[model samples]
Target: MEPSNDIKGLIRQSPPVDVSKPYDASTLKGKTIVITGGANGLGSFMVREWASHGANIIVGDVDDTAGEQLVASLTAQYPDSAFAFQHCDVTDWDSQVSLFEMAVNVSPHGGIDIVVPNAGIILPDASIQFEEPVLKNGRLPKPNTKQFDVNITGATYTTHLALYWLPQSGSSPRDRCLLLVGSLASLCPFPTQTMYTMSKHAILGLFRTLRSTAFRNGVRVNMITPYYVSKSNMLKLPVEAAFLSGTAGGATIEDVIDAATRLIADEDIAGRALCIGPKLKSAGVHGVEDEDDLMAVQERENNGQGRAVWECYAGDYDNVDAFVKRYILLLNAAERVKGWFGIVTDIWSMLRRK
Candidate 1:
């Protein structure tokens, strides 16, 4: 049986994104940003976006050549705004720490305002086609790759390093934010892409849980989920296979610059996922609610009262100061408990003697 002609026609359609709104350059004035995997792909586009927004950008990527080239280009274009590029492997702790420290040193403000953990690789083996051959047979097959370690684990390492560095860099935690570059795969379950999907979904959960972990620290965390971003015009397809090929080529780039532009416009929208796509509904939304409405809902749910919850974990605190304070409090409480127990025991013993 031949594939339907409609599928071919649908592939001819241009990808969705409005280029009408010119990006605002002043969106990130006085802000400093660090982007990982920023030499190419979505990360690179973000670098330009942030730079154009008047942000001092520090880009980290494994590709030295491209990373250097990008830095040189940015430096030539925006010499006033500090733009530095360093080779960083997200999976490596040393590299991450070095990158952050370098960024802090270069920024005139002494701290980074935004840390975009955007560095990741989509391993060729990540495709889900092997398990569901029937569904993927008619569709173009994706390369089988290690999507989890590169996509999910890489992101984790990046976030962890950012968390580790931010508190120590002499910056108020409230002023720092972590923007995790997630994907549409994280929300929807597309066939044959389970690894990428699962990892991305897990990332969303991590960002959600991070709110609780970072609440006391005053750090805000968020994620951006982008769908098929255009990278190359040549790869633009007239069929499903061609469409997949275009994305794989990383040829057709998306309006990622615009997405970052929009991100800076809103402050109330935090600890949520911002999905980018062709249609309005295509931009999937989650975890966003007005402050008053949220409070009202919480009040009703809690009978007009609400208590904040804190997670007690040893890993969150880096200093002996917090630990010593907690230990002393616990010890003091224990002493009081012992005194009361002794009194009760003495009363029991006295009764026995009687």
Candidate 2:
């Protein structure tokens, strides 16, 4: 028999997010969120927005000066809201553990609702001399792997901890989530920045695999992949040069914040990924034309003004391989059998220890 044309079983289509529409910001109120590398750049931007919406935030970063300054400013502005800064080196596991402990200690409810593994770095020297050999006794020197350490290992540590703590803190399973920050490099290879590209690809892989089964743990997993962002006036020349050379325009910090807010505020969304790029004034959605009728309808609804956020391949989980499908089914079956008895026993054990 000929192969069927139905791939929907393996990958379901994801609904497009209406960026022009506003989400309920009130959903973030009173939630305690932990963000790694929340001292500057996109992390700082998210911190301000989440705090403005009444979320208590714990920012972890190695930049003590910037972290302290940011915490002070936010604390003063939102006096009733909790804001804390802890020194965190993502490359170090112990440092991350300490940061999580501090976050829980500072939280009013003694629990963490959301965790954002946003810490990342791209060293200039590492990228510049990625393949250059250091001549020492004619032996090939060990290539620098700090980029992987911070981007992959650090993210892994955060993921492990988030799985443990998020469930412990929330009264409802819907409140638990892990938000991973990836880059356009996650989807496409950047030859100039090999280490950075490799690291992001690893993160994208983690996001894909984790989302497939995170629901079994009652945890929601979402990710945001952003294109180059030109924030400073000094960087505009290079950004313009890239644009002139046929490269796509960079996304804005506001665009990223908007995408992230939607994920944080909406509890029904899970196993989703959003890619943020430059805004466009076209009447049609870019890069999605598999369904001509649906695209035409979307174009009519949008009219013009193409949004920066687009859903990535989020349906792959719907039709997973046999192993994954069986694993998820087995987990669901076990949960049904265990029921409240397991939960009660676990609670009782906790209470007795306390």
Candidate 3:
């Protein structure tokens, strides 16, 4: 007889996160975390919050002044924990590899437990556009790769390093995670920044791809998609503010941080993503009021109460075709066999060490 929840096993994914539930923050204690773009903006905020909870944090950024100063303050505030800074220009391969090496050397456990690819660049660029072709000397201008290079290429480099280091580093399920930070542009289009929007959308693709097989390496892959959010003071920049003005509610930095906190703290949440945005009230015209109210379209009608985070893209595999279902089932079967093989290998290694 077919099992009641056969598809659940086939998917090989953790259940949807219950945001109302609580998790242990001290789980992060002594866990070494390496983050890119940690010198300023959202990365800096996360570094501060995580450090307070006793996690060892290694920050990598191009801003030498800000990165060094942030590390100095963290060292003072959390003397018992670990904090290190490495000058990493994400666009450069050697710079990032050096950053990873520094993390391993300075980590309290001599390994990285969590890796967050948290660096991104978003500028009002009409270079990859048509309204203004940006002709150079009355000719077509070359399309710059700034947005793709940083947001896409740089992030992929971080992911490559994490895949190499995390499996050897983690001791348990709670100890391994590759947390990706995608932006509001990941879901929808932006006006002037075509490349920025496209790059964030590519993040969604990366998340899906990794989640499918990253678990075989003993690492959990998760992503956070935050809505139009202001970083530090971006009054001088035109992109962030322009988008929020048209949206129903603007996502607060606090909410974005909160969303990421949930994913990082909850070890059981694998292959899941949380979308953070301005909290809008639940609408009144619903049959089942909160069935899938986390989606933005559902919140568009009402304006009373609100929430910061919601589980987004939870239905990707929920509805699939026959070929996909069969393929996933085969993959799950192989994983089961491999799981048993890995258990034997681990037992043998432990006895050998003794």
TM-score of each: 0.62, 0.78, 0.82
What are the lDDT figures for the candidates, one per model? 0.60, 0.78, 0.79
Ranking by TM-score: 3, 2, 1
lDDT of 1 by residue, 217-246 (tens): 545565666665655221234643564653
Local accuracy of candidate 2 as per-residue lDDT tens digits, 172-273: 444777999999899998777788899999999998877756765667788999887657131357644664366556788888998998987877667788
Candidate 2 TM-score over all chains jointly: 0.78
RMSD of each: 17.5, 8.0, 7.3
Give the C-alpha miss distance for residue 181 in model 1, angstroms: 1.1
- Rank the models by lDDT, top first: 3, 2, 1
Model 3 alpha-carbon drift over 4 Å, by segment: 1-11, 127-131, 170-174, 234-243, 285-304, 322-354
Write down the lDDT that model 2 would get. Answer: 0.78
Clashes of each: 15, 1, 0
Candidate 3 accuracy as lDDT? 0.79
Better of 1 and 3 by lDDT: 3
